[model samples]
Target: MPDRAPQPVDRQLPTDEARDLIALVRDIVQREIAPRAAEEEEAGLFPREVFRLLSGSGLLALPYASEHGGGDQPYEVYLQVLEELAAARLTVGLGVSVHSLSCHALAGYGTKEQRAEHLPAMLGGGLLGAYCLSEPASGSDAASLRTKAVRDGDDWVLTGTKAWITHGPVADFLTVLARTGGEGARGITAFLVPGDAPGLSAAVPEKKMGMKGSPTAQLHFDGVRVPDSRRIGDEGQGFAIALSALDSGRLGIAACAVGVAQAALDQAVAYATDRTQFGRPIADFQGLRFMLADMATRIEAGRSLYLTAARLRDQGKPFSRQAAMAKLFCTDAAMGVTTDAVQVLGGYGYTQDFPVERYMREAKVLQIVEGTNQIQRMVIARHLAGPETR
Candidate 1:
């Protein structure tokens, strides 16, 4: 079956500008993205031109400062835009989130000169970006990353490997975290490195179950030289900056998760209402009706959870715990809702004919990325009952 345009979500947006922004996003997605999403994803083709289009449209920099080519929108508005994009295609939505995450360290902690020199090109010049924190040996324990950066007069020579980086091979820039001191979080530092810098090379992209359109690869930095001016924050502050980025990144993932669930729910509802059995529409059956109702409820709850966390962030309040909860709940909800969507489609859901099976596969990664759902639980626990004692 051909892909249907998703139903527009009814949102209580904060302002007319926010509403208009979402309308624009929907128009772009319908016209430019959704039609090609399945075919490109099936062929594992990353849509670089779509990203360039988003950059030119100013959709790629919605949550940052206006002085530096960003839209200066609040987190709440930015996230809704993500939902709309994700509802159309996971690669595009999550790609936006990762690019925003890659920009976070420099945008938040860099000096005025650094911001002015780099932020505009990064935010709006159509330059793609990647975040480098995970190593082959360190996925969740990012503080223990062993990528080393040695100072050499006015430059730093970096040598290590970054694993599972989104946009790894195609990025125009990288936000890298490398150890500059002793072990653990305090020893690390953040740097903004040019993606094509000498000695920076990406391994082949990973073969994945879903979101194949987004390349995930391991980057090798073999004596990649970066100037001292490229350092994002003080030495030993990289891990802190990474954690801060992940706090917001988690919310981005949460919004994307809700988008995926909403998309799946939309597909399920359409299928259920039109698909017939016993000479009657499946919509007449209570069993399927209850399933559809539950799916919609979960999507609503997940949307509400993420938005509540976003509101806390926009107020400049401490929202780490809320972010964690939103990430955990929203992703799990995506996984469940997508699975139920497949069930609603019966045998067709198991095939590649419908998108729900792909939705199911795509939903799985959301629980595992940003931070695993288990890690999100630990984060929430530390906020609630305090950290666990060794």
Candidate 2:
């Protein structure tokens, strides 16, 4: 087999470093993560060891500053790494993205002392993180959230329930948004709450349709107390921080979407060639071949969109709209590609015996989370409509 002939390297996309990073990630994911994904997902078990592996490999801290033991890679490179990870295991990839979102507040808004205290543990420790912004009543309209953080002399006491928090049950820390003033977005403030804080508790994990291994739950904060030093930014800045973090987070989700679509396409292509129908490989059939071609085209398009958004971020340009577009387009593509992949596989695709079915289930969440495709469309439309219309 001559070592199975080295896989042709993907062409460098604007930078050799980015290409190298993607290849490294792909190698790690194919060798380690993909092997255990089905078992973990079947048992609804969290991939603690996998997170340790990622941290050890320096993948967990790719986009953070180098001073904090990070890889100091650009977002453009970091996102492609995420794509490779997701193609292997959605649970782990999503966990990484959510942890990165949780760290964004500290990286973007924390004072020097705060970053020194938190960044190393978050970036280097094999610990996961969760973002607590969405409440049961305030999913899209986060500004109207009722969670409260009241000043108590030298400390702040938080009380609220955060809904649909990824990594909620096992996270080491949470970046929480709560109302510290009057109503509306301006009244909100961000807090860095340790998972073991005295009054913080996580509800039983949700029985979700997909990404079951990633542990989603409701986080209950009942007078969780922390020193004033835990606040990420000045009063009334939480909403802004959350929104800014989301712009970046959306790109992460978009990358995950592309990865999921790619995984489906890969599985479908392999199955098509190996499984024969009418005495010939189904891959040789024009109709099935066209479907595979379409899947590949969409996956590449999704990849390009996210990479473009990432490049804009690297250049310090406004990219919220681009991020939203990528999120919307790629996630929808994932859903479509995965669904068609099942069609290509026919009966086997509907069963756990194949990966495409699982890919389809996993693809649905990408469309809903990170501000649903509906919200992404709204954000993109608002951007296109200009400031006056917005």
Candidate 3:
């Protein structure tokens, strides 16, 4: 069968507006996004126009201050929206999360004047963004990134390559973290650079295992001069800014993971009930039923965990550890659930004709992105046992 409408997600929105917003999203997914997802992904096409439509529809900036053209929704509402979108297409869902990550440095750390001047355009002005922190030599050890920013007369000159940047080839802006001081984390600072800046260019995108519709590439920043006014936080503050953004970004990934898992489970259940073996529907078999149960359980648990972390964030509490745990558990659950989904469908699941195989492929990246599962574990351990010995 072709892709079905997005599986209806039972939601507990706090307000009527949130409910309406979700309804709008579901309508968009069914009408505009879902039908083209599989085909476009197969073609490795990025639907840049979809993002513009989302921006025009006020769906692009839901969790920021309303004063800055944001919807001012809480993270609780925002994450649920992500989960819904991700269920339809991982590229669109994860792309929004990354764009939000790209907006983080400015939203959280930029000066009041900066926020006023830029946040409006960024949040809903139909612009897309990318975040730059990792390099060829520094993925987990972000502090070891060699991207350097030099202080010139009232301007900062940036020169270095950032690898694995989402939306790199087509971003409208970038929130970049670069070294300015010594050798470690404290030496870093954040800057917001327009995509049209001189000497900034993106390499060809990577050939990925999945989410091919989302470009992942290396960005070259060679003597890109950004006025001091574009500097987000103080010099020596970029690492902290980046970490803080990741704390929230991880939760975004967690929600997306749950979304993909839910989509896979939906497909599996649909297939199992219709396909028969031993003179009965496969879903009637105890083994198949048990697998479906486990998949649903994990999806539920992942949703609850991510929402709990989002609630903590919305309440102004420190939620870094919970975010890490959500990222770890939800992504692992997605991997396992999707893999099992393929198995439940037997030979049919292994084929490209079905989306379960695609789900399985997409789930692998969630475990690695935002932070690898191992990195997430280390983060949680630090909250429990403190930093490791050098």
Candidate 4:
């Protein structure tokens, strides 16, 4: 049987504007993004034009300030948009999230002049971005990053490589964190470096388990010079800036996890209702029904968790712990739901002929990114009790 398109999610949007925004996004996703997703992903083609379409439609900068060419939507609204995009295609959804993370430092801490000069171009000017915080050496201990930036007469020269960078090869700009002072967290600083800086280059993209259309590569900063004017926040403040971005970025991952799970559940339901066993629809079987029910429940719970975190953020509440919880639970749920989706399809599920296998692979990365689920437990533990003892 030909695959049916996934149904639109029933959403509780806060405002008419938000409702309309989601409608527009769904129209774009269905008309342009969804149909091409499987084929393009199979061919390992990056749909750069899809990102450009999103930028032109004012969807790329939804959570930032309107005065700086952003959509100025609240985090709650913005994250639902991510969920919708992700349900259609994760590359597009997660790419938007990473781009927003790349812009966070400048939008939040850059001088007014810097905002005026760079923010508009970044938010809606069809420019892609990458955030550079991780290195080959420092993944969880981001404080131990070895990338160095030395102050020259008027420019800071950056040296070291950024690993596992999303959009690394294709980004037009990078928000980079590098060490500047003595060892540890307080010594790191953030800078906005043009992607085409003379000494900056990208290594070949990683051969990943899934999401092949999205590039993940190492970026080499070989004494790249960045103007002092492009520095964000104060000196030695990059670590804090990176954390702030991750707190919000975690919510993005959570929403994307829900989307992936939702998509998987949708596929499973569609298949079960159509595929028959013992002279009845398999969905009518109690065991399969229970499995389907559990998948639906988990997806709903994941969506609620991420939205709860986003609302707390929109209300200006401290939501770091909640974000970590959402990231941890939603991603793990996605992994389980997608794996179950494959099981629902029985023999057909494990093949490329079905998307659940792909969803399963894509969902695995959500547990590892933004902060590993293990790290998320530590963050949540610190909030609940106290910092871990040595």
**Residue ranges of candidate 2 with Cα displaced over 4 Å:** 1-20, 387-390
Minimal lDDT window, size 10, model 2: 1-10
Please give, for residues 312-360, the per-residue lDDT of candidate 1 as tens digits: 9999999999999999999999999999999999999999899999999
Tell me the TM-score of model 1.
Answer: 0.99
Please identify model 4 stretches exceeding 4 Å from their true place.
1-4
Superposition error at 192 for model 3 (Å)? 0.2
Model 3 residue 33 distance off true place after TM-score fit, in angstroms: 1.0
Ten-residue segment with the worst summed lDDT in candidate 3? Answer: 1-10
Pairs that collide, model 4: none
| Local distance difference test, each candidate | 0.95, 0.88, 0.95, 0.93
Relative to the true structure, candidate 4 reaches a TM of 0.99
lDDT winner between candidates 1 and 4: 1
lDDT of 4 at 211: 91
CA shift at 164, candidate 2, in angstroms?
Answer: 0.4
lDDT of 4 by residue, 1-390 (tens): 223345799999999999999999989988888888888887889999999999999999999999999998999999999998988888999999999999999998899999999999999999999999999999999999999999998999999999999999999999999999999999999999998999999999999998999999999999899989989999999999999999999999999999889999999998899998889999999999999999999999989999999999999999999999999999999999999999999999998888888899999999999899999999999999999788
**Least well predicted 10-residue stretch by lDDT in candidate 4:** 1-10
